[model samples]
Target: MDKLTVPTMAELAAKGESPEILFWVGCAGSFDERAQKITRDICKILQHVGIKFAVLGTEESCTGDPAKRAGNEFLFQMQAMSNIQVLDGYNIKKIVTGCPHCFNTLRNEYPGLGGNYEVIHHSQLIQQLIDESKLKAEGGESFKGKKITFHDPCYLGRANNVYEAPRKALEILDADLVEMKRCKSNGLCCGAGGAQMFKEPEKGKKDINIERIDEALALNPNIVASSCPFCMTMLSDGVKNYNKEQEVKVLDIAEITARANGL
Candidate 1:
């Protein structure tokens, strides 16, 4: 991957000439090409609707969510502190993140490091945009014949109580929604959370994500939509590894939203 280039929150604040919002593109969004595209699309939607926001790219650094989940509290603290210093220098008071893990960490964990800021997941912001008439579903396209299911990321649903925004986004797409047996607050883990993204999964009866994918597939949905990049990556891999990729597609909520918006 190319080296990440991002402005300090302060620099972005100065460039915009008015303090408004900063978009925190997490490590996955920064490193993964597909995730980056979704992040850009979200930013475009927000910007087109008159929401002033700046992208904090690689400069935003890792929120150390994986480190914290991996039992490396010291490393987590160090990373959190470094991020706090950067945000403080920029005098940033609010942030929007594309990745759910980063969203959970910034919103729930940063205060412990003496960093307090209003943080929002992209889903929340997008929902706001829709409500304010800043975004609207394009009229001509619809997935009338397609059936889809949503996989709630633990960090987004259980961790942050964000269970509606992505669904609302999908609803606008006009897809036939199928509820998983284990969804929402009782949702199954993708086995990629708690820094499981950084390490190999422990040997178990079955891969947690594979099990989750199997559940989604049993419903015979055309797509598996989720809000987290990690979920997208893991679920997509599970489908491919299990030789079921042809039967289902994995997409980020932003990607689905963009499609619905005709972007």
Candidate 2:
């Protein structure tokens, strides 16, 4: 896929312009190759919809989710303050993020520290664009009748009560969207939450991700969909552990929307 050339806030500000939304590319979106693809796909969507969006680029930092989760309040505050300074400098109000971890921190946790903004997950932005008719299946209907099951990210679903935005975006694909036994408010984690992704898991009879994947496999989904990049990693690892990589695909919601829209 050709890469989309996304602009930075500084570049926009140099021209005395401001974007409608600031695209907050979290740590994974910046450093992880797999997540980077999702970032590009989301950029394609924003470009396709003609939405003026900008990133912080080198100025963006971690949302301190891992630090706070790892019991490092001091570090979390340090990181948050730095980011808040940069954002406030730009007078940014609306922000969109592809990672639910960032979404959770920015929307729910940043206010107390004087960092307040209307933060939205990428899925929510995509759903809004589709609803407003800014985006559509121009080439053809993609994933029509294909079996798909969504694995809700803990941060995006239960934490923020954003269960419908993702599903609403998938509904545009016209796919056979299925739900796991545990979904929405009762969703299961992929074992990487609470800073677990950075360390080895303690002994458990069954891995959380494997357990979640088992439920997805039972549904025989053609694609196991995810919204968060961390969930994408855990679920893909789970599928590969079961030697089902070829049979099932683990994709981000942004990737699916981009492909469906022929971006």
Leading candidate by TM-score: 2
Candidate 2 has which clashing residue pairs, if any? Answer: none
Candidate 1 lDDT tens digits, 123-190: 88888877877777774356676899999999999988899988887776667999999999999989
Instruction: State TM-scores per candidate.
Output: 0.91, 0.97
Best by lDDT: 2
Counted clashes in each candidate structure: 1, 0
* Model 2: per-residue Cα lDDT over 57-137, one tens digit each: 999999999999999999999999999999999999999999999999999889999999999999999889888988776
Q: List the residue pairs that clash in candidate 1.
A: 10-90
